[model samples]
Target: MALAVRQACIRAVIDGYQQAAISGLCPEGAFEAAVDAVRMLDMAAVLQREETAACAAGTENIRREPGSVR
Candidate 1:
């Protein structure tokens, strides 16, 4: 699911770049910036997912342990 989201984001950026280029409104270095933005977003998404998973695991462990209080 995360991979799909990342791919979609990249595709959107590419499409935007192409459209901007065709309209002659794409500033120099804008495409690189867009790509960098996508990478940062993807990394953030990954970190969020990892944190969520860790939290879920901790919750489960607490639930399974005897006398563990929330």
Candidate 2:
């Protein structure tokens, strides 16, 4: 994902948490929940990048090896 998109997502999450708190609807674990949400998002982005890199590498290997197609 692009940096701007990722930043927008993070900002949205933070804004949601702030709105909830301001509306007096915040739960006991609201802070933790927000933190976890952000962490999960970051982890997901990391995993996606890794997966893409791995896939590209795999494709490159197949292209380099003769008779590799099935």
Candidate 3:
């Protein structure tokens, strides 16, 4: 991810923490939830990248098939 995107993600996490703090949730719980959200986001990005790479790899196999038209 670009630096700008990473910074925005960090900003969002901090904002969530602040919102939780204002809503009377305990700091520890809020922190844990915020961290979990970040983890989920990271996982999603990783999955997307892996899917893209797999698709690219599969194309190579397709083009190599004897009857392939590409």
Candidate 4:
């Protein structure tokens, strides 16, 4: 189930990139970079990395008030 969802998401992203490229909106390097990112989209690994980074930054439960900027 998860694999199917992930693959679907990747396909959607790729389709969007291709459409942008066709419209001359996506640069060569940008499209390649996006593809590279999609290739590395591992849900578990990405979540773990993000959790670790958030912990290191001490932003685990940090939040901004309404109308506040980062």
Candidate 1: give the clashing pairs: none
lDDT of 3 at 48: 69
Q: What lDDT tens digits, residue by residue, belong to model 3 across residues 1-70?
A: 3554576568668877887778888989789767765665664665567668778988777646577567
Stretches off by above 4 angstroms in model 2 are: 28-70
Q: Please write out the lDDT profile of model 2 over residues 1-70, one tens digit for every residue.
A: 4664567568756865776677676575566556655655655656577678778978776644566555
Better model by lDDT: candidate 2 vs candidate 3? 3
* lDDT measured at residue 42 in model 2 versus the true structure, 0 to 100: 57
After best superposition, candidate 4 residue 4: deviation in angstroms? 0.9
Per-residue lDDT of candidate 4, residues 46-67 (tens digit): 5576667668778746788989
Worst 10 residues of 4 by lDDT: 1-10
lDDT of each prediction vs. the true structure? 0.66, 0.65, 0.70, 0.66
Which of 3 and 4 is the better model by lDDT? 3
TM-scores for all candidates: the values are 0.39, 0.37, 0.46, 0.38
Cα shift from native, residue 54, model 2 (Å): 28
Q: How far out, in Å, is residue 3 in model 4?
A: 0.6
lDDT of 3: 0.70
Model 1 is weakest, by summed lDDT over 10 consecutive residues, at 33-42
Name the top TM-score candidate.
Answer: 3
Candidate 3 stretches greater than 4 Å from native: 36-70
Per-residue lDDT over 17-39 for candidate 1, one digit per residue giving the tens place of the 0 to 100 score: 67666767556655865565566
Candidate 4, which segments miss by more than 4 Å at Cα?
28-70
